[model samples]
Target: MNPTLRPRRLRQSAPMRRLVAETRIHPAQLVLPMFVAEGIDEPKPISSMPGQVQHTLDSAAREVERAIAAGVGGVMLFGVPEHKDAVGSGADAPDGILNRAAAFLAERFGDQTVVQTDLCLDEFTDHGHCGVLTAAGEVDNDLTLERYAAMAVAQAEAGSQLLGLSGMMDGQVAHVRAALDAAGHETTAILAYSAKYASALYGPFREAVDSSLTGDRKTYQQDPANRREGLREAILDLAEGADIVMVKPASLYLDVLADVAAVADVPVWAYQVSGEYAMVEAAAANGWIDRDRLIAESLTSIVRAGADAVLTYWAIEQAEWIGARA
Candidate 1:
């Protein structure tokens, strides 16, 4: 095979390939998403997500410590309350599980790692919708914005450095930012889930959070068929004062992530959601794929597609792997 150029020259050795790698995954670019369940005596394993648990407050703190030691960039905390209400009042209560977990992490490792909280009502809502419902049972976008603002302030007061607005409410970023600044938390950051799509990839996440959702979220979340809409959402979030923009279900939405990253002035992130993790684990358990190698490859592809950071279930373990190689 004669050729003008041999690309194999650079792929001849491990060192050569690594040196010429266009994308690199690092420990500091990975964020761990954790759940702290209220009234639990111990961490409860999520059946759908193998090896993942709904942690108690104490267990969550210890896990954060370990993640910091592993050089993980940050942790995004979600709270699971024992009770749920129509308006999701627990979401803004100072004594709520998520708020308490945020405070605990901040007090122990505030300067050690970035402490972020999910500013959505779904986990705390009886109906399992991300926001309050109207008389017609439709999601009330304006009312949800108010709830999100209050939740943002509560999370900020609990020392969350970043608020992850994942509710898919209109003007949520602007409303939350205004509320934070009004509460004298001007420095607190907003990590908006700008391009979240209503996809089947969220199945495992419902089990992890014990969600009660009876229907879909297509009314608010972006449609999977629209790529341009994802970019528009990112631009809207940036204009609304979002510090970071994220695309959810990363593996299936790498194209959206790339488009968002192209024009985003702020950091762009992608979430390798629960279902994605579960599928990999399931395949690995069946001896179908190399788990470690797949993890590294999946994350590297997200980075190569233009994600500045990734929220992944494999954060801690992958960080350790990177460290081992280094």
Candidate 2:
């Protein structure tokens, strides 16, 4: 350990530190998550997630254009329907908000960017479960699979390039994949929510989608404590022909994201969930932190942990900042 071998040499200048950085985060590696509500004449602000809105079709398209201009990788669309049913019929209806929004983005963006849709029923179902329910008032796993398969076909028909199976239902990847293939949509890929946990970090998203969740998702989503369990979920998803696997609430679960990325042969993604964004914004608003720097740091950490892409509310904003830097 000679004094001349000290790390201070490399840390002597900002440019030197930048050159030695281990992970790189580009605007093109970020995906923006957007919400489109049916029957909304004007964009409705989500109070829980400040600056986020449930947009009308036109506004949604405008936002996508802005994101594209900012150089983001893609967008993940969520629909907030004007109606809900026990079976979540809107999830498969051609006229559903999600279906129509996907079509709009596809027709506008084409191959310029990837168009993904959130393949979940929470925003469409009356009870706010991500699937069909049983008479016993529980989420029926097998029944949900059927509904998800139908939803997948509907999304693919609406021009969704990738379907994000965020419900955490068992066998969902296989069911959706089979349905897409049967419908001759062999190119429609599946992004499996492999390590999604039942977390409090989803509060803002629930408000954004106007969720009616009366109970927790512990029955379907993974437990937060088990790292090995996360790996197991990724393996199952990969076996079911998933093109990508994801870990939700990325900041709190980087270790889990790392584990999933290690074994997943396909691309691995991480969702920087609503709460994560809110906390950073809140702290910055209070002048307790340097917001822009922290945002870049948080996103870079996820990339450093091996996430191929990150789903974030800050995608467009971050992309703009990156563009400015460039």
Best by TM-score: 1
Candidate 1 TM-score, C-alpha based: 0.99
Query: Candidate 1, which segments miss by more than 4 Å at Cα?
Result: none
Candidate 2 C-alpha lDDT tens digits along 1-326? 55756878888898998799788778999999999998879999998788999999899889989988999999999999989999999999999999999998899896888999999989999999988888998999999999999999999999999999999999999989999999999999999999999888999999999898898889899888878888899999999999999999899999999988877889999999999998988999999999989999999999999999999999999999888866
Assess every candidate by TM-score.
0.99, 0.98
lDDT of the candidates, in the order given: 0.94, 0.92
At residue 15, candidate 1 shows an lDDT of 96
Off by over 4 Å in 2: none
Against the true structure, whose lDDT is highest? 1
- CA lDDT of 289 in candidate 1? 100
The residue pairs in collision within model 1 are none
The candidate 1 region of ten consecutive residues with least summed lDDT is 1-10
